[model samples]
Target: MATPRIESHAFPRSWKDLIGHERIRSTLSSAIAKRRLGGSLLFVGPPGVGKTAAALLLAQTVLCRRQSAAEMNPCGQCPDCAQVRAATHPDLIQVSKPQDKSLIPLELLIGPVEARLQEGFCHDVHLRPMQGERKVAILHDADFLNEEGANCLLKTLEEPPANAVIILIGTSEQRQLPTIRSRCQTMRFTSPTGVEGRELLRQHIQRLTEAGQSPPSLADAELDEAIELAAGDLQVATRLASGQSNEIRGKLLTQLSASVPDPMIIARCINSHLDEISKKEAPLRRAGLRDLCSIAVQYYRGELREAARQGRYNGADARRLDRTLRVFREIDRSANLNALVDCYAADLSLAITGDRGSIG
Candidate 1:
């Protein structure tokens, strides 16, 4: 159980304070006034687009006992409101996909949730809020819920326990479970445009400077770098400002320029750059997956261009190009289900070290 959220200096107070996703906030706010709130809301959006934060706000709004119908928002001053804001409210159950691994098995969710349901929420967690009236569960990175995990969630969604509400946060529709999608009240968030993305990065830079942790004269140029790396994820951008150092652009360019001796060599060159990526498995693998997927798109685009050299493109080449385009279009797709990076490594090794294609 996380700590009850408060309006302390550490926490954000208003929906507008979030960097992106105004439409999402508006929908959630509107829902609060309706007689029947979405018991299960699926927040589908790019990471750092305020999904989880919105979930917390919704939890606060629903649990606030003294809020007026007009505002339909929590009085950040109330104890319940503060607790939920602090992430310490006992009834506010938060579940995240296992960060250590690529996927979350439904089994993990089943036992604990069932046990909690049987015990009537309080037994599973202690220090229930003295003020809040209901239970809220936030399932973050819900797209990683594998078959069993999603089924467990589906069961709960089908028959929600009294006074319990569930919010599922996912990156994209492709990542989400279809049945889960059908069941929940859906809300979608798009990546902020380049301009919005830059503004968000600037805000993070300002906040860090205001904190005195970073020097006031630090180059603001890195703000754009942070935005590009985050791909418009406000959370990622802020995290970068707080010290999550991403690879410098030059290194990535160097890696991409492997000895492209031939068709097979091109693949090997790619693998050579990524060889050590797998070694740093646990903590960095998630980022590795994102990078690998993005790189694959780049590789395919290059291949399609090469294929175009064969003035009359064949059907096979066109199909591969089409698949590549699909992957590019769905930036929010979870690469957890695929083994492309591993396969790329193997194929590249076969080309360079084995009998397949060769490159010096």
Candidate 2:
């Protein structure tokens, strides 16, 4: 039961406090200052990369009474800013997929069947601001919005209330419906990488230490591995730093590096580790499985690179890397966790053992 060194809920309150996305911050700040920001925007990026945080900051900047939107600054002391910080703002409406549900229900968008358009997000978004001049609606997990939900939202996006700002946060533009994508200004966000990533990790560790939440002394090598494996995701990097990543990585590499890897054993090992990480929560388990798949992708990629460097790269090595990558992609859309894990292990073992004919 390791305590999280960095809480995901601890989001940046201002542009300066956000870690990466310098270009995005600059563009947004300029737009806010010029009062030319769109009424509807889509924030697309990998998870844990500050899409939601930036949305909050934008809402605060627009709603802050002490400073005009032209200032592009939020006076944290203002009631608007304080309410946004505490998620109690009357004008700020937020929605996301429920933990038990796989999709953002249509009812959440347009009220229940008996109360359609009477008491839901769409209905609420149209109301006059109670404490501010404009309403700011943020819809998280936009990727989970089913077709019906997306259709119900089109009206709001097409003709929003005067001075209203609607922000949809998702991982990719392709995941959004075409009609939904066409009506909004899309801002793409990327994870911090290389030197920027390392610096951010250092800053995070320092913050944890200052707050007396730092884990046991971490070696530079451990930090470097975490950074490399995280591939620019700060949340994953922190999880890697929680002392579980090493054990998980060791198990993966040990099985993957064996002379004759066992698919069953690999599958069991991965599922067991996923269970430990997720505590049987299906969504958490899916996320944990994705993280482990990412680690495996890194492993295969390293092997491929090393082999190429030594002039030992071959068709078998290439296939192994390819299969690992495919498995990684499957984790996102697949629902059967146990079957996916089994197939992933079997496919990789087949690739590694040079049994290409038996694969697929």
Candidate 3:
């Protein structure tokens, strides 16, 4: 077959464009160099830690036209590398959530995504590349793949096609799949620091300026504010910049800044957030716990930061906030919340009268 034209929208082409996760990057590079790269790679990380980005970079490396037996990562300017970055390389497949929903429904596993999987898992890998060296299938949000979906993809996982690579990316506890998980080499990414995140915002700005386009999603202060709210999740910061965050950081900050001296209101705020998530959070699901704990931590950090900055909150209000934070942490750590929050509510009320001993 003739080499197809590279088709993806060109993105910032290398791992360099993605901030932090240096450890994960180094491991992947080493694997590629040793030609010991696994057919199945599990990128386990917090959201926005560049799991998806690194996967794409690896895809480009695997399919690079110039890669001989010698080099692993492709020279980005090469046709194969460019094509992968643009998301158009013929042999590369990008599988993500179903367009209509927030997740990949089970039907999709046996549908278009799997149809492609069927072709390449066995016979296709042995065939020469359509235009480049290998076929790539990137499974984003792999954790959302239900049991049936996971089983459906097992054939490929068990016996990946020759010269073929499958990349699985998922966040938090969803990152692991016991049977499938055992088969792959896992690369983990963590949230970067406020400092690192700000630096990335600067680079994004430079890129936007050079392109003569509207600058990237954040102004420096906006990025800092967002990173603080997100507890350093770049993906969250990006969403905030884009006005797409599920939670409005600015509005929340505003509310927190108001001089509400009432402990009831503080208790109520804590109840509302926990209540919204109570049913789904059993504290048993690792993914759910990870998300919940992270959120609570961020909330407390934001509250404290706001309180200190505004200086509008009295000690009673601050005490209630602190109590809520501690209780949330306890819940996150697997404490039974039905009783904990009730006691927390009482302490929050009594805390105003100078009593902190009984809640414990």
Top model number, TM-score? 2
lDDT of 3 at 297: 46
Q: Candidate 2 at residue 287, lDDT?
A: 68
TM-score winner between 1 and 2, please give it: 2
RMSD of 2: 5.0
Tens digit per residue, CA lDDT, model 2, 1-360: 011122334667567878778899888878876777757899998776778888888888888999987777788788888888777788988888776667887878888899999877889889998987888988888898878899999999988887689999998898899999998999999877656665566665554454556545766677677777866566666667656556777888888787557899899888988888776577678767766766876777788788889988656657766776566445554457888788778877777532336332
Better of 2 and 3 by lDDT: 2
Candidate 1 lDDT over residue span 1-360, tens digit each: 222232344334666666567777666667556755646778888665657667777777777778852374567787777777767765677766544455664434654545634342223323333445567877776777777667656666766655667788887877787888888888887766556666655555565565546533334566555554555555555555444334432343343344332334434443444444554453354444344334444554555567678765444334433443343323233343234443434433233322223211
Q: Rank the candidates by TM-score, best first.
A: 2, 1, 3
Using lDDT as the measure, what is the rank order of every candidate, best first? 2, 3, 1
How does model 3 fare in lDDT? 0.59
Candidate 1 RMSD to the correct structure:
7.1
Question: 189 in model 2: Cα distance from truth in Å?
Answer: 1.4
What candidate 1 gets wrong by more than 4 Å, as runs, is 1-11, 69-72, 105-108, 112-130, 203-212, 215-248, 254-281, 288-360
- Relative to the true structure, how large is the alpha-carbon lDDT of every model? 0.56, 0.76, 0.59
